[model samples]
Target: MGISVTNISKSYKNAKALQDISFEVKPNELFGIIGPDGAGKTTLFRILTTLLFPDQGTATVAGFDVVKDYKKIRNSVGYMPGKFSLYHDLTVEENLNFFATIFGTTIEENYNLIKDIYIQIEPFKDRRAGKLSGGMKQKLALSCALIHKPKVLFLDEPTTGVDPVSRKEFWEMLKRLQQKGITILVSTPYMDEAALCDRVALIQDGKILQIDTPEAIVKHYPTSLYNVRSTNMYQLITSLKTYEHHHSVYPFGEFVHYTDTRSDFNPEDLKVYLESKTLSDIQIERTEATIEDSFMELST
Candidate 1:
């Protein structure tokens, strides 16, 4: 087994951080948990990594019970947290060696597993960890996590705060690791990143809305969507929400993704309506739904 979570729940004082959450990550599969901040992604990661105890439910990682076999699970998995937790005072090589030593393994013992990532930072091995660029820091953290060749890897928002080019490169590294039979579980708030995973779970306010392949999730969008834009972006949004036939209106990049309340709605009629409201240069075209669109529909 890779990971199994059943009815997991947690609370902090009066607030419930996670509410009866449950999901499975198949062995060797890249599973993603997609949600924004305060959605309980970190709480769930901490519980699975054996760093925190849940108030309810049960979980297992790498076929070992999270509560009963915490020690075994910690040894069998590698975790790269959302923030950089490595020693800033230590040199790159020094930090790497420290982590490896903790797991009773030397870098040379598992050089093959982290060679792809380590090679990129090896040139700066003499430099202090705090002096490295954001991308470099990310690579070093990942390298340290993989030093012991864990069977399961848990990356919490690995690409968050990095450049787009670096983000792309990071995902490529994860795919190569998956090829070597390491089960991966990653969490991200970016909808685009969700598509790269084999499957995803959309969560909001401590509850799971839906879980499926990205393609299947978008296909399940219940209504026809359209891209709407006009001279005034703010007014266009305001006017659409007040329209008699409007169903859902959300700002997606430069265009407003809108759905109609009527099944036989016409774009031309909407354009005419906008014109009557003093909005000009109105453009409305049918567009396909995205993961974000499906999430908005479910959360609403």
Candidate 2:
């Protein structure tokens, strides 16, 4: 129905790109891969889309083996790479038509497939892709990818570098596409984007850290977290380190997020100790866990 990857790995010039990465994407589901740059998200996406083969694993898209059925996989999946890969010299309409032709189809033949997204940039159909805005170019690229009416779409950081409004619009477009039974696998570096996916895989250094619904992942954070702030931030940080019970303390915005040095330490004792040191405007409050928080917790 969707995609299944097993023990995939790849390396480039002695540097590992993917290390035994594995995951499953269900049909009609919007699965996201979240990680920062150089985390192997792009490498994995390329392998799954059949643009590259894994060094030590097997994958299947729509039940077709990725390596042996490369052609079939290509025909069944639409991929939008992180970089804008459309023909710069070609007009929007030309680029769209070119991709359609390559897949042995015409724009009109798959008009229904991409009409919603394409129409937004259709008025500029005659404009060269190189001259269009970042968001518009992204829309055009997606339309071209979908022109063949593929069942699964792979977007590698498709919203990066776009304006906030455009980023929101792009995700909305993805939701609409999913309604038509198109399964989506998207990779993004933005932590906030993880919440938009039905499920997400958090990856780092070519290894997956966790895979679950965004809510579930955040809910799994085990330690009690507190937001502590003081006037002398540097001093407060240096002093907090001297405490024997300090578990983890890191700057989080205007405050330092801290967990107890000992599980039994009392918040009242911590407050009293801070006051005794004349740390002005001191405040400590429990904070909700976010994806970024979870990532920091896991990575540390």
Candidate 3:
């Protein structure tokens, strides 16, 4: 079943936590909420999963109202919070069993649903949840979240603080889960991870900046982009920004991304411009727009 959120918003004392956010997730689609901390991702997830109600607008999960039909929404969605909130002292198996029992189900009943992910950590099932590594703890938490076999899974920053390998593995497992026809809505602060989703909504300061497929967002990046590297990267940034034609300059990996004021400016022009500014060992090249680049452009 699909999820739909329409103009949903929430607030704290003096600050708005979410501002007129709206989006839709198709059945079995892997949709992502991409943003940095304090972007209202957690607040939106909480509202959608029926943990909290929005001050404005409405949302439905599998055709159940978030507020009035909270029970149905709660039962239909599996939520993995940003923090690892399972019983720390409970063993992996115990945690899984606990969650299953809460839903009036057994781990074995849903074993096939999570078998691929659970088996990886099954050998350490007897280990205390607190004693497990970050990645293993994540896996165990996910296993518990899925023990009930909900139709929609909401993962809130599930890969945060884990190692790169574990993060990659977690995403792979999510793809496998998606193949089972379960809808997934995940929130992430990592730009690169945005590409993994079928569609993403980039948010900032409690507001939606843009929403589109990763490729569409990147393709919409404005201006001619170039990556310039030099021996003195810091000085190069300063000098480039001071140049008359320099439009915008920011650090991008080992190089600085820059745009020129004039549409006529080309690679050879950039080389001459840098050389005139006394920059040495300069390497300038046009570069493709990445999710991060699109985000930076939109955020500004």
Best by TM-score: 1
Q: Write the per-residue lDDT of candidate 3 for residues 25-130, one digit (tens) a residue.
A: 9999999999999999999999998888899999999889999999988888899999999998899999999999999999999999999999999999899999
User: Each candidate: how many clashes?
Assistant: 0, 2, 0
Model 1, which residues run further than 4 Å from truth? none
Cα lDDT over the full model 2: 0.91
Q: Which stretches of candidate 2 lie over 4 Å from their true place?
A: 232-243, 272-278
Off by over 4 Å in 3: none
Per-model TM values vs. the true structure = 0.98, 0.93, 0.96
Q: Clash number for model 1?
A: 0
lDDT of 1: 0.95
Among the numbered candidates, top lDDT falls to: 1
Q: Write the per-residue lDDT of candidate 1 for residues 131-250, one digit (tens) a residue.
A: 999999999999999999999999999989999999999999999999999999999999999999999999999999999999999999999999999989999999999999999998
RMSD of each: 0.8, 1.9, 1.4
> In order, what lDDT does every prediction score?
0.95, 0.91, 0.92
C-alpha lDDT of candidate 3 relative to the true structure: 0.92
